[model samples]
Structure formats: C-alpha cells, structure tokens
Target: MKQILKTILLPLFLITALSLNNCATIFSGTSQDVEINAKPQGTTIIILGGTIGKIIRYGAKIQSFIDIFSEYLDEEDKKVLERYSFESLITAVILEVRGVVPVERSMSQEVAKVLAKIPRSYKVKVLNTFGMEEFALAPVKTELKTSGGYAVIGYMSGKKIVVKEINTRLNWTILWNVLNGFILLPIDVLTGAYKKLTPLELDMELNEPGEKLSDYQAQGPNQKILILVN
Candidate 1:
C-alpha cells in the first residue's frame, strides 16, 4: 500500500505544480539587466547591416523586400530625404525588420505597425556594398512580470541589406515579424531576448550572454527551439 500511494502522490504533486505555473512564461530572462536609464524617445535606431550580395546568395527575392519596407514608411517619411535638416534627415533608421522567423515568437497583431517598407532587391547592386560584411538584427526581448496584472516589454529590430562598392552604396530592406503569439511590446522590446536596453538604444546588456539563442541551432522541421535567423 505504501509503495502504491508513493507513486500516485508523486504524479499528483507534479501535475499540480505544472498547472499553477502554466500561465507564467516558461522561458524567461534572456537580456542582461543593466542599470536602465531613461532612453531617448525614437532616437538611436539599431541597423542590422547585411551585405546585399550575401542575402542574394541565400534565398529571398528583391521585389518582396520593397513591399515589406514600404509598409514602414508614410508619404511624409519618404519626403524626409528632401528635408535633410539638422534634425530631419530621417537621421538614421533602425532595422526593426529581420530575416526569417521561427515559430512561437510572434506577437499580437493589433499593436504591430509597419513604419517603413523597402522592396526586394532588383539586382546584386546592394549586396556587393558590404565587402562581405557579416550583418543581421541582434535578437533581443524582455518579458516582465509587472507588479500590476499586465505584462510589460519593449523591443526593436529590422532588416538591412547594403551593397557596398568603395564609395557607391545601395541598400534594400525587407520585412520580418517575430513572436506574434500574445507579444505586446515588440515594437519596443522583445521577450525572447533577455537583455534590457539602456536609455540609449545603441547598446544592450545580456546578463547570461553565453546562453544559446532560442533552443535550437539547426534548420527544418527537426528544429524545436526558436531562432533569430539572418
């Protein structure tokens, strides 16, 4: 009787614990918690500069890129090039769009917005600019169990392909949306990446920097863990 009860009770206890924790984030804590200061509003965009030649070397057409990039900008923003004032040069833009996305990292559709869209590449023109530079969005996300009953997070990312040729530069951007299932603040911060960005958006601190991104390192259906692919 004692042996039978032990086995049954053990299973019950495990089940109970799992049920209680089900609503909470199973995989949390990816970014390093640096002393967070007040970051400037809409300044310091992170650009993931990829060589146009390389992205072409991989799969991904050029036309699809323009459409994706176009969704991000408005008619007014397009005129930014002409405005080129001290503050109106469109300054520098961040590449919030990324390459391929893995499953489970999608976000809520309501809050996401496309500010600017860049069509796909027409030629290797943009690809050759990087001189074989390695580039892609640095995956970052933070899930906060707020004091209130709400989850608060911030994230930013984008797609950037630059074709470099000594002086002449060409670039084509694309669209990439990761973590669409129930994510709230991906426009500000990503939940999958465990680092918190500082007041200045340029740098981030991942406390456990050594941890592997997502849970997988390979490709195809065999891949179980999500990844920030280039």
Candidate 2:
C-alpha cells in the first residue's frame, strides 16, 4: 500500500514540476531587460512620439464607419481609410486635389473630391511637441514591455538626437513546452510571455548641433559632459 501511494504521488509531482519549468510564463516572463548607452554617457533617453499609436487610434474610427456602411466601401477603400488620421487624410485629399501627392490607382475619385472640400486649419510651429514621460540617464538598464513603443535619446536642452523604436518578436523558448505536450502554451500566450522585446541593447552616438569635431578633440577623449534635467 505504501509503495503504491509513493508511486502515484511521485509521478504527479514530477509532471507538475516539468510543466512549470517549461512554461515561459513561469521561467522567461513577459517583459525583457534592455541596456541602453550613449556616446555622451549622460545623455537623456525619453519615451515619446510614435506613428503606431496614431495609426491604431485612427484605425478604430475607420473600422466603426466600415461596420455601419458596409455596402459603400470595398476592401481597398477600407484599407485607405484605416491607414490615415483625420488630419493626414485631409492633407492627402488636398494634395490629391492640387496634384501634389499622386492619388493611388485604387483610391475612389468621388471620395477624394468630397474630402478635399472640408475646411483646413494650419497652426504654424517651429518645433513639433509631444508629451514627455518616463526618462532615464544613459549607461542604464531598464525593463521594457514585450509590446511595442518608441523612444528618443536627446540632450537636456530638448534637442532630439536619436529615435529608436522598440518592437516585439516571438519568444521561441515557449516551444520547450512541446515536450510537455504544449499544456502550458495557453498560459504563456494569454499572459504575453510568448513574446520578446527586440534589440535587447542600444548603443547610440549623439550628434550635437553646431559642435565641430575639433571642439570635441580639444576636450580630450576621457572628458565627460553631464547635463541634468529637472
């Protein structure tokens, strides 16, 4: 009786351990660590300004219109509408009207004519603005989500030096669950543990405007410039 009980419990324990060990959710996790450094070691890195977010926001608006008026739009028309924001759509229509930006072969002429007649507004600005949130000084390690986002590395003076986009890829480590009959695959997929953030490290060179190469040569190779942002 004692031997039978041990045999039954031991196999159960081993199977449970194996399943957990092979699961990406338990072993690899959902977020990845990225190390970022700059040529000027103290330069600031900021997360801001991405076209992906805009596309997604406008796509949902276009999708709603498609669902309501299914008969009016074909597949090509839906694709064109979903790709642009209201401002961008208006600009494109105006350009098509003026023969500036060529109208695509698939674009409907009637739709373009209607869109071009809408009122246009222009606000002149020297520099584009974006909300700055989450920043770090370089030669630093940070954990980024296994989802997509954008980042900009710049000086404390607010001049953008480099723009980097973070994207996701499949985490092949989840394939290890094949040995466990893929029992834990659902958990990994649901928790996003099956994805990994690309470009695990960043080494960026800064281009400081109006600074000659001779200016940096005089400062010597070991000189460090630290700019603080409050």
Candidate 3:
C-alpha cells in the first residue's frame, strides 16, 4: 500500500512541475512579468487583465526590471498577484520579433513600420532589449481585438493598456474641457487624439523561421521580444 501511494504521488508531482514550467503566469489586475515575443528565441510574456501601471520600469537604458520587481514583491505589505506582476495583464495580442541586435536604431525603425500597419484600437510600443545578456526571446505576431479591453506587460517595452468604452456620457463632458481634460489620466485618448487611427496592410511572421534559420528544431536566445494577447 505504501509503495503504491508513493508511486502515485511521484507521478502527480512530476506532472504538476511540468505544467508549471510550460506556461507563464496570468495576473488578475494591473501587473505582470511580460516579454514581447520579438524573435525566433523563446521569450516569455505574462499578462494580467486590468490597468497597466506606469512605464517607468522599461525603456532605453533599463538594467534589471526583474530585480526591481522582485524587490517590490519582497516588501512587507506588497504582494505579486498569483498570475503575474502588477504591470501587465490587459493585453489583446503580442508581437514578438527576432534576428537583429536589440540596440540597433534600425530595429526600432523597422518595428515602427510594423506598428503603422496595426489597427488603431491596438496599443503598441517598442520593447527594449538593452540588458538581455541571455538567449534571444521568442516572439509572436499579433492581431488586435477591438471589442475588448487590453493590457501589455513584457521585457523592456513600455507598459500599454487599452479598453473599450464607446463614447460614454462622462467622456462627452470630458472632451468639452480639452485643456483641463488633457491633465487627466488617459491624455491622448481622452482628448480625442485617438479618433484618427488607421490599420496598416502588413504581415509579421517569425523572422528566423521565414529565413529558414530556425536551426531545424533548435531555438536560440538572441531572439527579440515575447508576446501575449487576449
């Protein structure tokens, strides 16, 4: 009886461990440890389902957001959500790119060109790649969803949050006060600046895979950002 019990428990434990290792966490609110899927590499993107806090943690010269976030989680009263960090969760889709050096300005420009083709309803930004001394991250293409709210969390890209509110009554009054209204939270969108968004005619695929450089079955770490979408 004891042997049978141990055998059952051992297999269950292995299954649980494998399951945990396969997927990223999903937080409930404004939080995450997301990585934009930008390359043929295996990068991870985590998402929550609410407001994306500030974008202070990432940009041109970030050293280590993981370290910072870890410290934040360690604080006495602070706690990381069961699924992800408080920075990313409300995302609809993630575009992970790979191949080129993360710091090349050309990389940024190329990414921008891709963004130009995305639907206006989708919130997009560049994910930074300055501190990754490790393997390239895996990236995924995205197709934004208009009817749902979104949040994005990933390595080096600034945080982005998009929601669907079809011109509410309060929004009407807010638009009447442009100057003061701009001071409120969602500056651009609240000021009617987002009304003129257009989608681009383009397609994004795995660069390495497209080039036939996928190394057959092997993956690399020099890939770009990871992606997450609703």
Per-model TM-score versus the true fold: 0.18, 0.32, 0.19
Model 3 lDDT per residue over 38-96, tens place:
32234333322222212222211112223332332333222222222222211211332
lDDT of 1 by residue, 1-230 (tens): 99998774543333223222212212233222211111222212222124322222232233333333445556654443222211111112111223332212222121122222333241123333432222223432332221111101112222111111111111111111211112322222454432322311213222222111221111211101111111
Candidate 3: misplaced stretches above 4 Å? Answer: 1-40, 51-85, 88-137, 155-230
Candidate 2 vs. true structure, TM-score? 0.32
Tell me model 3's lDDT, rounded to 2 decimals: 0.25
Who wins the TM-score comparison?
Answer: 2
Residue-pair clashes per candidate, as listed?
Answer: 57, 0, 49
Candidate with best lDDT: 2
Better of 1 and 3 by TM-score: 3
Name the lDDT of candidate 1.
0.24
By TM-score, how accurate is candidate 1? 0.18
Error of 2 at 171 (Å): 13
Q: Per-residue lDDT for 170-230 in model 2, tens only?
A: 2234324433452322323486433332325656677654221111111111211111101
**Candidate 2, poorest ten consecutive residues by summed lDDT:** 220-229
